[model samples]
Each structure stands twice: as structure tokens, then as C-alpha cells.
Target: MKKFLAAAVFSCFSLSLFANSFSEEMLNIYAKLSVRFVLMSTLKDELSESVNICIGSKAEDERAATTLIDLMHEHYPAGIGEYKIYVIKSDYSNINFCKEASLFFVLSIEDIDLPKVITFAQENKILTMSYDQVLVEDGIDISLFIGREIRPYISLANIFAKDIYLDNVLLRVSKIYKKQEE
Candidate 1:
């Protein structure tokens, strides 16, 4: 109907106003900001003096993960707040490696069972984020989109189910993803 058409057009227009491109610099900035939104209580016991991040990708490819790590180190040489940033590349085969991380960030990956990663993160209370917004639709907790400005695309339901809550400030600025009811 006319309402549906109007809504769709408005949605597209709103997206147009925001940045839709990807850059490692912007992604690193937003990714760091994303962690700041996690309540201290949620991470108090899980993290010590460091904020561990697992950069996950396919077994054969680690280019994106490496680039992200490089960018993170270059940008945040002193780390974020009181916690130092510790990053490791994960192929998702060694669950123990990822278990030590507070955040699991999905890179460019294919042919891997991603739901299993989500399940693992939920069980472990780890925040799951992705480089691709499309993965947010697939249930990754958060992804950043940038063109004119930085915007976080998030799955609140997914993060909430894992008992991972983001600050209201982030929720206010983010584009939350909701699955279409079938």
C-alpha cells in the first residue's frame, strides 16, 4: 500500500544520509567505541586489565584480520581507557583461543558455520561483531557503516540473549536490526 511504499522510500533515504562505505580507520574507531558501551559490570569479571579481541576469519585467509590489528595498534597505541588492547587472529578451530577473548570480531569469511560462533559467544558472554553489515542480519551483534558519518548496525536481540548489553548512548546513535516476522 501507500504506507509501505512511503516507509520503504524513507528508509532508503535515511540510509543515504549516513556513511555506507568501509574503511579500516573508521572501523577501528567505531570498534573501540563499541567496547566502551559495554557496561563495566558485564566485563569486570570477564576481563582483567586488558580487553582481549579475537579477529576471526576463514582458515585460509587472514588478510582482513591482520589489517584490522595493524590499524588498531596504530590508532590506539596507548589503548582505550584503562585497559590495554590485546588482539589475536582466530580461525575458530581452536575454541580455547577465542574463549580467552572478550570480543569476537568476524572478518571476511566464507564456508564457515557462523551460528556456531554465535552460540559459543552467547555461552561465553562474548560480544560478537562483524565487518559486514549483512552479517548483522545473520545475527552478528554489531557492524559499522560509514560514508558521511559512522553508524553502527546492531542486533540488540542477539547481544541481549548473550547477556551482553550496550550503553543507551550507543543504542541511540545506532541502527538496530530487527528480523522481519515470518
Candidate 2:
């Protein structure tokens, strides 16, 4: 709990401001990072068909959720041309939400049951990610702000991809999780 608060405090600068206005600059960063991961982690030599990816409602009306959907949906083909990506909106619950996501984003701790979220993600072979303070404390993958930009990082130490492989192009985007003492 303490760790999460510290992380949230450090990252609050990027998230605390909510103008209800979407920033293209922010979206661009997300798009690039996501493209890097998708391309790198893809398990194929040739491009696969459309895959169903899920994003959670991290905010009321899910502003961040929509932003992610737009990023994945818009960038995949434009950036990789041969492959297609699909973003599924999560219902934010154990049963439906967890089931819907192949890649799940943690929006906020307040909106989730951490243990359940983690368990469901692992059991379902879903990749869990978050920008939430608490989930990060619990060692979930997260995207964080450095200066004005936030980037994706992960806790895949316990999570592994099988026949699926992550390529250098995507791994370049993932900064391995290293605990920083506050």
C-alpha cells in the first residue's frame, strides 16, 4: 500500500490533470509505444490476422480506455500494415471484464479488486498492465511518466509467454521492472 502511494505520488503529475480534452501528444506517445510492443511480442514470422485486445475503464466514462482503444485500433495497420488489432472495452468486473481482455490495462486501484484482477489475468493467459499506483506496488506491469512522457514497463518475471515470443522491436519498448527504493 505504501509503495503504491509513493508511485502514484510520483506519477500524479501526468494523470492528476483531467481537462476532459484528449491530447494528441499523449495519444501519439501511447500509439508508438503500443506499436513497438505489438510488433515485438508477436508470435509469428508472418503477420497474423486480427487479435482481440481489451482495455479497461480506468476513468469515469473510461476516457483513458477510449484513448487506448483509439491508439491500438488506429495504429496497428497503419504502423504494421500486414497485421490487424482489435481493442475490446472491459466491463470492469471479474467475470466479464477479465474474460474480455487478452491485454488488460489497470486504470485505477479504486475501481478494481487487485487479487482477483491479477488472478484472472494469469489464469486466462491475459497480460495485465496498469498506470495505477496500487497495482504497480503489487508488481503488475505499468506505464509511467518520465518528464512529460509515460512509457510501458512490465512485471513479466512471473508471467511468461509460451509458443508466443516477444521480438526486439517490442521488447525495446518494455523496460523490465526494477524496484526503486523511495
TM-score of each: 0.76, 0.64
Q: Which stretches of candidate 2 lie over 4 Å from their true place?
A: 1-24, 42-48, 58-61, 77-79, 94-101, 145-151, 161-165, 168-174, 179-182
Which lDDT tens digits does candidate 2 get at residues 3-66? 5555455544354344343344555555555544544553334435644456655446376667
lDDT of 2 at 173: 58
After superposition, candidate 1 runs with Cα above 4 Å error: 1-22, 25-31, 34-41, 146-149
* lDDT score for residue 91 of model 1: 79
Which residue pairs show collisions in model 2?
A: 40-167, 40-170
User: How far does residue 33 in candidate 1 sit from its true spot (Å)?
Assistant: 3.9
- Quantify all predictions' global Cα lDDT against the true fold: 0.70, 0.54
Provide the lowest-lDDT 10-residue window in model 2.
13-22
Best by lDDT: 1
- Give the distance in Å from residue 169's predicted Cα in candidate 1 to where it truly belongs: 0.6
lDDT of 1 at 60: 43
